[model samples]
Target: MKKLILPFLCIFLLVSCKNETKQGDSNSNELGTAVKDTVIVEVPKVPIEKTIKEIKEALTAKGFKTFEYVDETTKDTILMQQYFMAFLKRSAIKMQNEEESERLQKLHMEHLSKMHELGYADISGPFGDDGDISGVTIYNVPTLKMADSLAKSDPMVQAGRLEIEIHPWWAAKGIGLR
Candidate 1:
């Protein structure tokens, strides 16, 4: 029994290591050069900075709600712009297979990319914790109806995996997330 166990262990280790060695040899160059993995990140294009008057003019031209006030400390005129926030909540039907789920997720990302490219959604992402609310998309559009239409176009939302609840959100113009 001892002799049999020794041979079995030896064969197991030899077979396991042989496959790894073969895999390594197949990836090596003639000169045995090392390979490095590369990662690429896509940066969104930011629009040119506009003056306060220009921003107010643009917002008013688009029929958006805005209010201004002077800060006591800085004394700078603060321009508040109303944006729409779409809360992506988990829906009742969560019955998609893995393949269908993957396809829907891909389509959802494409929809988000198009929104960003069209300057409709300022930012979108999922929540860290698993909760009723899954994600949110901040729409830079002026009207709630337009924002609702955009959110409804998402594949996940259409497929009954998620639901959208839109609300008006306000923030200072030209302000960015820290």
Candidate 2:
């Protein structure tokens, strides 16, 4: 997150030069005419193409792996983006009481919901069987480090009830399950 903010902050500081003149302040000219304080702010006009380019550029800037492929049937360009699959596994710690366990479970669900709401996770679900791997979450983040951090931020993982194993995965940029 800091990586995302610093660069934009620097650019904003550089481009955002504002005149120090106040509203009521009037600096007289050589002729003693009243000079009104004026400030210039240029709002950029972005077209659709430029927006698309910026999205691609941002993805690349974030160290995301992406590629475009021409579909044979429709001859349309398809963007394939890399995602991370987090395997939520069982941890050694299981000492929580019933009430505490219930609370942690609720918090865990809330965390997952927030991740989905924030577009950080594409999909997440638990496994049916009682196995070492408990659940899986597909993270729609740019880098493995980001996915790892988000996964570690899960309440269950932080409580030592679950462990995380992540791997790089890929899919169509805008494709959804049927």
Cα RMSD (Å) per model? Answer: 17.9, 18.5
Estimate the TM-score for candidate 1: 0.71
TM-score of each: 0.71, 0.66
What are the runs in model 2 whose C-alpha is more than 4 Å off? 1-55
Displacement of residue 58 (Cα, Å) in model 2 is: 4.3
Candidate 2 structure lDDT: 0.88
Q: Pick the candidate with the highest lDDT.
A: 1
- Ten-residue stretch with the least lDDT total in model 2: 17-26
lDDT of 2 by residue, 11-95 (tens): 8776653322222235655555557675689876964354435666788997888887889999977778899999999999999
Q: With candidate 2 superimposed using the best TM-score fit, by how many Å does residue 143's alpha carbon deviate from the native? A: 1.1
- Backbone clash count for every predicted candidate, in the order shown: 0, 0
